[model samples]
Target chain A: MAKKSIKIRAKVKEDIVTVKALMTHPMETGARKDKSGELIPAHFIQEVVCESGGKTILTADWSGGVSKNPYLSFKFKGASKGDMVKLSWADNKGKSDSVEAKIG
Target chain B: MNLKRRIVLKGTAAASAIGVAGLLAPRAVLAAWPEAAFTAKTVPEALEALTGNSAASESGDIKIKAPDIAENGAVVPVTVTTSIEGIQSISVIAANNPVPLVASYNMGEGALGFVSTRIKMGKSGDVVAVVKAGDKLYSASKGVKVTIGGCGG
Candidate 1:
C-alpha cells in the first residue's frame, strides 16, 4: 500500500516556527482478520520522530491503540522562516516514512 | 452433459456466496479493527509503551463528547476538546481493546484544541481522551455500550 500523505500547517509565532501535522493511516491494530478467519498480525506506527533543521524536537512511541489517521500538533522552538521540519514514523511491519515541510 | 452443467452452476453459487461474505465482514469490523487493542489488564503494562508513565489526570477542561450507546460498533464518532491554552495534543484510548490508543492529535500553535473522528470500538468499554499541553497532561472519558460487535455479528 502507498504511504499516506501528511497535511502540515506551518507558520511563525514570536519568531519561532510552529507546525501542525496530520497523517492519513488506517493504523490497523493487527488483531482484525481477513475473511479467511486468520488473525492479521498487528501493524501500526510504533515510533514517530519530528526534527527541525537537523535537531530533534520530539520523538513519540505510539501503541497500536491509536485510532486511524492520527493527527499531531506540536511546536519547535528557534525555528525561523525557510527552515525545514521533518516528520517520520516506523510501523510495526518495519515500513518507514520521511516527509518534510519548509517553515513559512 | 447434465452433470457438467450442474457442477458449473454449483461452483458459481459457491463463489458468489463467498464474495458476499467477504464484503460484509470487512464493513463490520473495519470500523472496530482491533479487539485485543484494549483489555490491557494492568495500567503499568498498558502505559509502558507509547508515552511512558501516561498516568493521566482528569480535569473539567478536557471534555470528551461521544454517544452513550453505540447502535453499531463499526463506526463511533468521538470528539475531544480542551479549555486550556498552549495546547499540544489529544489521544483516545480504548481500555478494553488489545491495542488501546485510538487516536492521537498534536495541536500546534493557532490550531483549535478540538478534533472529531470516527473509530471502530471492538466492544463496550471505557473510552479515554488524554491531552498534553506543555508538560501537563489532562484527560476525560465516558462509558460506551457496544450493541453489535464491529468485527461481525
Candidate 2:
C-alpha cells in the first residue's frame, strides 16, 4: 500500500519522545449523508500502533466517534534522538497503512 | 462516477486479499477487535465485552482531565493519567454516545499509564476513564458539556 494517509513527527526532549500524528481520514460516522443525501458508510480507523526503537510503545483502538481527520499526541520514555519511530493504522473495513519517522 | 466504481471494486479485492493474509499471521493477544464491545450501546455492556467483567472500582489514582464545557462537540480534548502500577490497558468511555466505548489503549511493558487524545461527543455526558492494572480495573470520570455535533446520537 502507499501508506499516504498518515503524517507523523517525533521529537526527543529531556529523554522523552513526544510523537504527534495527523491522520487524513473522512471518519465517516455512517450516519452522515452525501450530496445526494445517501448514507455514508462507517469508515474509520479502529486501531493505531506506535513503535519506538523496535518496541511497541502505544496502541489505540478508536471508534467512529472520533472526529474527522483525527489528531493524536503522546509521549514515551527510553527513546533518544536518531532513533526510529513507526506508526500504523487499521480501519474498520480492513484497510491499513503505516509510516515511519526518525526522532529528531 | 465511473472512477468511483472502479475504486470501490479495487478496494474490495484488496480487502479480501488482506483477510486471507491476516488468517495466516500468528495470533496475538487483543489483536482482534471485540465487536460486541464496540457495538454495545450501554456502558456496562460495553465494559463487559472488553474486560470480561462489568464492575470497576472507583479510584482516585486515575485522573481525567477535560474541560468543564466543550465548545465544540466535534472535537473534545481528553487526557488520562494514573499513578497505579502494572497498568496494562486504558479505555475511554463516553457514557452518552451511541457507542459508549470511544477509545481503548494497550500499554506496553514499562510504559507510562498516560494518554491524551481528542474524541467526538454527540451530546453532554460523563467521560469515564478506565485503567486495567494487574487484573483489576480502576476508573475515574468527569462531566463534559457539549456545545454541538459531537459523536453519537
Candidate 3:
C-alpha cells in the first residue's frame, strides 16, 4: 500500500478510551485560487469511521470547511487496554486510508 | 482481423468497468454521506438538509469551547460537549463560512457525547453546536472572532 497518511493514538483510562487522530491532507475547498489564478478543485475527506472489536463507535461526515491536516478527538467506553481501535477516512475523490492503534 | 480486434477491445472495456465498480463498492457499504447538508450555504439550510428540521431550540446543556479570538482562521480549534442523554449526533457549523456546515458526527453505542476538531472560517462568526438527542434538536453557539480569513488564498 501507499505510505500511510493517518496517525492515530488510543489511550484507555478508567474504562474510557480516548482516541486522537491527525490526518495529513490538503483539504482544498475549491473556492481558493492558486498563484497562477486558477481555481483549486475541492478535495477533502468526506467521511471518517472509528471502530473497535467489530463495532463502530463513531462516524464523522466532514466538508471542505474543515481545516487542512484535520485533527479529531473523541471518547468511548467499554474498551480495555490492548484492544485495537481502527480509524479510517475516505475523501471525496474516492481515496481512503486507515490505521489501527492498540489501546495503551 | 478487424472483427477480432473489436472483440478484444470490448472485453477490455468490460473488465475495466468491473474494476471501477469494485473500487466504489466499499463506499456504498458505509453509511451514506450527506451531500446536501455539506453544500448548504446557510445554517438553516444545512440543518434542514441534515435533520429534516430547521428549528433548533437553544439548550444550556450543550457546551461549545472555542477561542474568543482566533489569530488564524485556517485552523480554529473547537470542541462540543453535551450532557443530554440518548445523544444521536453532533454537528458543528461555522455560520459565516461559504458552506456553513463544517462537520457532523454520529455517535454509536458506547460513544460519548463529545467531539473535538478544527474548522475553517471565512470570517468572524458564531460557531454553532447542534446536538440531536431523542429525536429533538438542541443547539448552542459561541462567537469566534477571526483576524485572518481561512478560505482566501
Tens-place lDDT per residue, model 2, B66-148, is: 99999998889898989898888999998987677888888874467778878888778999999999889899999999877
Q: If both were scored by TM-score, which would come out higher, candidate 1 or candidate 2?
A: 2
Q: Model 2 - which docking category?
A: acceptable
Residue B4 of model 3 has an lDDT of: 87
- Give the number of the best model, judged by lDDT: 3
Distance (Å) between predicted and true CA of A38, model 2? 3.0
Give stretches of model 3 more than 4 Å off: B1-31
Candidate 3 lDDT tens digits, B5-97: 545543443343234334444445445888778767679999999999999999999999999999999999999999999999999999987
- lDDT for B99 (candidate 3): 76
Write down the lDDT of every candidate, Cα atoms only. 0.61, 0.79, 0.87
Candidate 1 - chain A - TM: 0.83
TM per prediction = 0.57, 0.83, 0.88
Tens digits of per-residue lDDT for model 3 on A10-102? Answer: 999998899999999999876666789665666788899999999999999998889999999999998999999999999877789999999
> Number of the top candidate by TM-score?
3
Q: Per-residue CA lDDT of candidate 1, range B1-153, in tens?
A: 366854554344334323433433332423322222232333434444434556777888887788999887666777776777876666776665434565555544344566655666767887888877776777788898978644221
User: Number of clashing pairs, model 2?
Assistant: 3
Estimate the lDDT of model 1. 0.61
Worst 10 residues of 1 chain B by lDDT: B29-38
Per-model clash counts, in order, read: 24, 3, 0
